[model samples]
Target chain A: MISKASQSFQVASPSVADQARLRLAPVIRIALLLAASVIMLAPIAFAVATSLRLPAESFSLPPRWLPLPPDWSNYKMVFQQVPLKSYIGNSAFVTLSIVIGQLITSALSGYAFGRLQFPGRNVLFWLVLATLMIPLQATIIPVFVLISKLHLADTLASLILPALSTAFGTFLMRQYFMQIPNEFEDAALLDGANQWQIFFNIYLPLAKTGLAVLAILTFNAYWNEFLRPLIFLKSIDKFTLPLGLVNLQGYMGTGSISVVLAGVVISLLPVLAVYLVGQRYLIEGIMMGGLKG
Target chain B: MSVQAREHPASARRPRLFAKLTEPSLAGMARRKAAMGYLFILPTVLGIVIFTAGPVLASFGLSFFEWNVIDSPKWVGLQNYDHFVHDSRALNSFVTTGKFVLLAVTLQIFLSLLLAIGVQATRSKILRYFFRAAFFLPLLTSAASIAIVLAYMFHQDFGVINYYLGKIGIAHIPWLNSSGWALITIVLTYVWQQIGFTFIIFLGGLAGIPADVQDAADLDGATGWRRMWDITIPMLSPTLLFAAVIGVIGALQVFAEPFVMTNGGPGDATRTVVMVMYESAFSFLQIGYGSAIAVVLFVAILVVTAIQFRLSRSWVFYQ
Candidate 1:
């Protein structure tokens, strides 16, 4: 077969320089990748190392690469200096609320836009897409005033209320719903299942991966959200982890460097945990943002 | 117009008389489906109208009026815009933002592309996975926390970075202390945290390049840099554009890094447009000016994004 012949036919042998380059390329690539990984992981490793060292040993002439017999006192000091627990709790509540809210709103709208045919559907989807261009920083002024008017200023509700719905989440879920086979819907309809029944029982169950992607992405985003909390929440008691971490760093002049690093470590743990568990979903979802329209 | 409602095979197989009997109920069912569709979208529509679209319009309106939360808004059409023109600090902030966006986005894209190519070239799966995960690790941490950690590490005296450099016989670099290096440090810190997203995107794009095209390039004696530049780069242009667009948009709104690390200090070195907006609206209590700045930023983003698309036509390959 022509195809087999073509597959078997190798490119003409190269000169010595070309052969040398070919043999050296992968080694060079691996070295570069290894070097890049070291650069990426170095900061966090240093942070962890610094957090375990004493204040006196923190900035020694030659930095300690490893903190032997690691001190847990710096982490304890982080707790004493800041309300790390309250910050974690507040962040968890707000992030979970937003995640649940977005799932409901995005899923329902996504199902409708993806499956159900109606007048103005394309126009409505375009409207949603347009909002993606409007940066939150551009709109926060009015949002601030709106929150103030609602007498929700300085409350966690201000943080939670506006973020409960996301244009991006809707788009993501709509794409996900569109990928599901239409045959399932048709089959369910023939089985006499109403629209709500079909959605809840069949399609919703099948959309677990999509929902997980949305939830994880949303959690990572809002948990790390600083601008909204910085602008809205005035009280320290109402502070989220990011705001709290920044506040802790403000005490860098008085407190030990180890304590501040400890605080940083504490704030990142939950996100690290989520990432370790759901990395496949997170990476795929992020890739989807670029690869898909 | 609606999609044609799919007919059941049983209905299609039925006699014309029976089909006629079912046609009225099928119309009723279609109407109910439409109603359900509207109902499903109601919450999302209401939320968007209230939160996103309404705020956009309101911010535009507020740009024409001065309000400082405690007092009534006084209409002053064109006043904020005029002030913005004369405000050197605001203009300077935009310039700083431009510089940051240029340096950070370019490095972010270039580095991530190299990393993606490296990861893709690896023969060992475990090494590939390790590299991918390691690069993306920092993205899991908040910008605030990362900035906190980096601020300490980049300290001029008694910091780890300077300590290491000193060992290499290099003098201590004033990373965050001086205005010259502040923006660069911010760029480095930001790229460290944000490059993961773009790296993953480029990896996805790299995976999509066809094997036959690569083999053809190889047969043409295009190996190493030549192959990457002539074949790989052209094929990956669409993803590069996406990464560049997203990167620019994000870098333009650089806030948390500068806000936490430098507080836009050392004489407005790292002060970004969004930082200016935040200060005017919150710290300085100049709501109208902040809104005006916000409007300018919004327009800047729209224009920049539009320009990227327009320019991309010459370079971006569809396939």
Candidate 2:
């Protein structure tokens, strides 16, 4: 069916035939990727959908793909039925404090490791990295003891204070700082700037990307943190979102699928918002942070 | 130097300033550097020592004594160890954790590698970005939310999964309720959440691979499975080993998903060692017993990591 010139072209560079044969490849690959993505995202979508559906609409025989009349009441009910606002406030307070504290501590430590020359620098850096391998379960019991002994148990401070320093955060900032040129620091030093001024003015400006990444990561970790809150926070008033959601399960008891889904939706909003706003930085930061540490 | 300085006023001024800066004393500069270094590092050092290192050492010491929060510590050297060795519940948990690790890590690594290959084989940026976001979305979702949603999704009746099964004329399966299937459900959830991470790691490794090596393989008449086995796999070995080790460590400490989803349920079928330790410490108020289990888990992780490092030298090709 081909013309002579075209046939010669195909024969000369059989890659043409190969490309023709591989024309179906992209379609197939796209389909597979789409299918996998759906599988990955299905639960999240279902949570969102179920949250928007009424109690009767949620358990239909042929499950409703879309709610007939979108029920905004579930959102109202979540706030009314649970102490959702207090939990949100508590989570926000703990997460913000921890993020700020961790950033300051990590930046200081990272700059020390990256730029400063001092005795035992290598040894100290190695020690910090060593903590990354120690699983949290290994220290949970003692942490609980320490918290209780200090009478910080049943308070938000227990949640915030213990997480003020992380090995991964230090490692992330150090890697970021190392990428910056020394000329800027030298110039600052020659201009009679002290070390703190150099760090704040020179290093921090260059480390905006690192700080954004750390903020997103720290927020995510702190938001969903359950064990620490569960162990430390005894009162219902002090509970964070995760504990609130779990306690919501107890109130619903059984077959209150709509209410539970509503709670899940409430918990997910902040994280999803953070992700949508900081998507690019989140991905890049994860790639850099995860690979190094 | 003097002749050059004479030719440029700027050079002469710079030397004079440098001389003034350096003339204070060498010892003074040393003292300043030491003070600055400590000032910079003080917060982190104090935080680690008080928060991290203190708890770790306390845990080690607490493992030797029996104490509830309300009671005085009674010295029980190796009694908790003896109890751990003979306890059927502890043994079951150990086995369950091991099984979860083996199944979860194996499937996670395999699926992620396949995803990486699929992503690499494609040239369309749109499709690749879609898959990247899709896989990475679960990583963003909180484990607590995932557990709640998945628990509903796997509901025995009126669940989407069962609806599909009924449409296909198959019987409903109790995913979280049956002892046999409960652990598998948790394992699948673990894989679902973790595939994004493994896929990302693989993608990072894939980007590091040179395009010419793949092109040369194609020129040498390698195609499909041959190309993958001979060229791709060998080149990606370092990433594979890294993923494997991380997967192992993560799997061994698996807690949140199972904790939220099944609560180590259907009659202890999914009781992980961490869950056991958690119960021992908090529920039973047996600090000494929990500490012993924690110590055992630590040693196990160390051994596994050491073995992985040893084994990696032979097969992991770093370029």
Candidate 3:
């Protein structure tokens, strides 16, 4: 026991020490993660902090980590300097209409593909899927021309109508609907309900998760949309949130940093609210879509 | 309900009798199905035709002719394609776009994977939710707002980044003004905005992995580094590949940030291919030339995607 074997045993025990390593591993990993999280969150937190600071303090030599006397007036000035309220209103109106339109169109089409029987349904569904491969940039010029010809340019209609139908939304809904048992609809049909009634009553309720996901995605897309609005809407009164923020640049320059920061904060609040409310559904929806891809 | 039964009895009776009359023929049922199906999908079909397919074909046709919105089209016959193929600006745009995509996608996928794994190890539900929300904050904010805030933050003289650099005793770098740094700043911004999405996808992928496999590996003297390398990485390859593909596609279309932040400036270092297409179509009114560039970009995406799929066969182990 007190021979050469004792030396090897001691070294082996140190190498094979599971309890110490296992206990230390997760703690170290979590600490590193927490540090990383702080780095990831710092800039956004700073942005929020700067928005609340006085304009002079925003760019102080040793930048203020937190404001002394928070200049809440920066938000007030943002509203006064730009048509921030109108922009928010327009964004909400357009985003809501687009989401509603997409919901109706996608649900109907998804039901058709998932449940209904027809000639060439597969072909049509595949055709819709094929459209997703084409980038939006390639179609923007023609879309611009089409909007101009319809005399919808410079109107919110241009923003709302074109985005009301998406292949991704339809596909997502179809996949979700297909997962639902047909027995529910069969039961409704046996009770003398018509197809439309069955869809509205049975299918729609069952597809709540899909609908929530679609609504969140549609709202996010419309809210963050920039190029289409930039090209189509000419009037400042009609500009959406993104366009308004872009125009805010002209007024603020580098001098009014606090006001600009306030614009960022103001613009993000609605989206943040939506994300918080629908976080669960959004995570599920994105995961579903990513898996198929 | 009683009023409908009484008033529309004849209409309902007729439909019932008619259905009985047509019950023998499968052709009638098939026709009914076809009609209902067409009715159900009509709106979506019409929307796609007018909005998506029509525009795609129209863009293709427009790519062969020269026309500003104010003037009639003039047939250019491959001239646009020739100009795009030989143009210096077009070449520079391709190079810049390539660099941005390579840098942004690689860094984004790597960081997201790391963050996702870290998130998986955490047991505190509150902290998990908080970190997830923090990561997703950038995605919810409008690109225009983020660009505005980041531009200020990256400002050379009075910006916070430079202020910190001075504190650390490093010389102030022109983050957006210099050509070399402008593209890198844009890339960093793109990565920051996109990492959350990648992280979420990886988290979803991580949750799908079986826990027993890890336990088996642990019992077999495979713990920590060996366990992760032998088990986790191989199992997570599908998610990695998916992220890589989407990340590359998104990176190639890097327009909004560069457009808002640098205007593709400081000698066009941040001028992505899409930015070039935007400028040509809108700024120069060269629709044909712009379309040609877009076509090239589209094909490049196809090739890159195809390459990814091909390479995925080797590394992507679907467990």
RMSD of each: 6.4, 6.4, 5.7
After the best TM-score superposition of candidate 2, give how far the Cα of residue A45 lies from its true spot, in angstroms.
0.8
Candidate 3 CAPRI level:
acceptable
DockQ values per model? 0.41, 0.34, 0.39
lDDT of 2 by residue, B1-319 (tens): 3454556665567766443333324454555566667787788887887777777787778888999878898899989899999999998998999899899999998888877777776678887887788887787766766777787788898678888888999899898899999999998998888888788888888898898996797688776656677777899998898888888998898887778778889889999998999999999999999999999998899999999999999888877
lDDT of 3 by residue, B34-126 (tens): 677788788888888888888888887888889887899899888888888789999999999999999998888877777787777678999
Q: Which clashing pairs does model 3 show?
A: none
Worst lDDT 10-window in candidate 2 chain A: A2-11
TM-score of each: 0.93, 0.91, 0.92
**lDDT tens string, model 1, A1-293?**
11222111222347886566556656666766777788899889988998898876777657786899898889888888888888989999998999899999999988888888788888998898789888988889889989999999999999989987778888888888889998998898788777777888999888888898988888888888889999999888889999988987886753578888887787778888998899988986787662111
Give all candidates' CA lDDT scores. Answer: 0.84, 0.80, 0.80
Better of 2 and 3 by DockQ: 3
Judge candidate 1 at residue B255 and give its lDDT. 96
Model 3: residue B54 alpha-carbon error in angstroms: 1.7
lDDT of 2 by residue, A42-140 (tens): 888887888888876776667665776779878888888888899999999999999899898888888888877789888988988898888888887
- Please give the lDDT score at residue B271 for candidate 1: 92
